[model samples]
Target chain A: MSVSTVRPDVYAQVQHFYARQMQALDAGRFADYANTFTEDGTFQHSPGAQPAVGRAGIVAELERFHERFADDPVQRRHWFNHVALEPLPDGSLSSTVYALIVTVRPGGTPKIGPSCVVHDVLEITEEGVLTRSRLVTHDQEAA
Target chain B: MSVSTVRPDVYAQVQHFYARQMQALDAGRFADYANTFTEDGTFQHSPGAQPAVGRAGIVAELERFHERFADDPVQRRHWFNHVALEPLPDGSLSSTVYALIVTVRPGGTPKIGPSCVVHDVLEITEEGVLTRSRLVTHDQEAA
Candidate 1:
């Protein structure tokens, strides 16, 4: 699998795609978040975890994840950096980024939650770039 | 003041420049970090703060800043996100990013320091992309 640097236009498109996707998820727009993915997209939270397959399944899993924080007043922000994009031979793009989960409550200092590395396979369609597969790995687990 | 999105190649170049620049600063390579800037590059930590002018001055100021934590065992990491790039009419690139300073002690969780927005004027010379001027604004102060 040869991975090469993506063109500038492709990089810009991917960045914008993530910006919208993360914002939707953080703002509790589960359906909108799922829309950023393909109909058959898969999301694996971690290794050995059952993957959330397909758009509907992804939304269901995200809702369950949000339920865990329903009673919490803390706001979570996803910060991504070191976004490295690679062009794959199969025409899909490979994007790897370091993701930081920052949580802050009203009148409190922000804290860093789990640090993760996310690997995403992206494909371009009539609607622009969308995720085809996503796998997140916790930093500690990787270490 | 017309700003437009940068070409894909420029974006990649800027990203790589930052990866090297930030690593040099965090690893205590003050001179190496300073070299990432143009000879007359300036760094202003916050609005109304006296800016460190030139590479020599920038290195000196950074050294002093590091001295304040010399006795501390905490490791500081600079994580930047939402890196937006624009092309300026003068052949300079304007880059803006949200920066988070994360500090962690041995065996302890990471805590976020001041959240800041950094605006940088970048120029590409024979040596690649270099910072011509940088201004950082604290989120709290902006609010």
Candidate 2:
């Protein structure tokens, strides 16, 4: 078995970046979330439909998502789990994050759901931020 | 912004581990998948029901999942995105991976689905294998 080359401090960075992502998402900070991606980033869903590519595209898509959710009076607590991050060569990182979402309606039962797999290839920005080259596979079964 | 402790070589190790994990999964080697977690590891879904803790429990849960699929006589290929491995102080790692699951029906069209998010905390075993401390989360919505 080969010795691990990964240093200990990367976890702190990733944890920090992810926490910000969650905070932005929960606070409906679409613009901020969009900025987490690289300049030429891409977000692809299913095989069909056009993918949201580049920083501008990500911003637009997040904005659209925020707008659509604006009408939903229910509050959702987005919980994530089963996450695995592997480092790639050339300064990029590929990671997988699984989510178990629970949507709560006021004075009603909360709806729980199965795994939503989010696979991404990320690059650490010069400013020490995590940006996406590609964010693939956002399970939308809950929607 | 703080400087990064995650160097390129470290990323390579993280990348290889995940590639091996997926390879084992696709080959129907469930035990290898289970072995990817630590002894006191926990796999949580929805924070309800008992977390699949320890190797035995994790194996049992995965067996159930594989059994259900095997009974259905389906052929599926769940593609995974790159792995992001964030190093922890103890030389362990926290990671996130994104996946796209496309299930092709028996002699039917392949149905594409949304991405799921998987969040995990893992530690490297004495043998150098990456093992999970916790595996949790789910899909956002319908595939």
The candidate maximizing TM-score is 1
lDDT of 2 at B107: 41
Against the hidden true structure, what lDDT does model 1 obtain? 0.80
Off by over 4 Å in 2: A1-5, A45-47, A136-143, B1-28, B34-69, B73-143
Q: Which lDDT tens digits does candidate 1 get at residues A1-143?
A: 66456776777767856765775676578888788888999999987789999989999998898888887775666888777988779999889999988766655666776989999999976557789999999987745
Candidates in order have lDDT scores of: 0.80, 0.61
Clashes of each: 1, 63
Q: For candidate 2, write residues A1-143 as lDDT tens digits.
A: 23334443554466568778767766767678777877777776444547798777877876776687676777666655434566788877776665545678778897654335567776766687566754444343322
The 10-residue segment with the lowest total lDDT in model 2 chain A: A134-143
DockQ of each: 0.13, 0.08
Error of 2 at B52 (Å): 15
lDDT of 2 by residue, B72-129 (tens): 6444445456566677787767787776655544444445455655566766555655
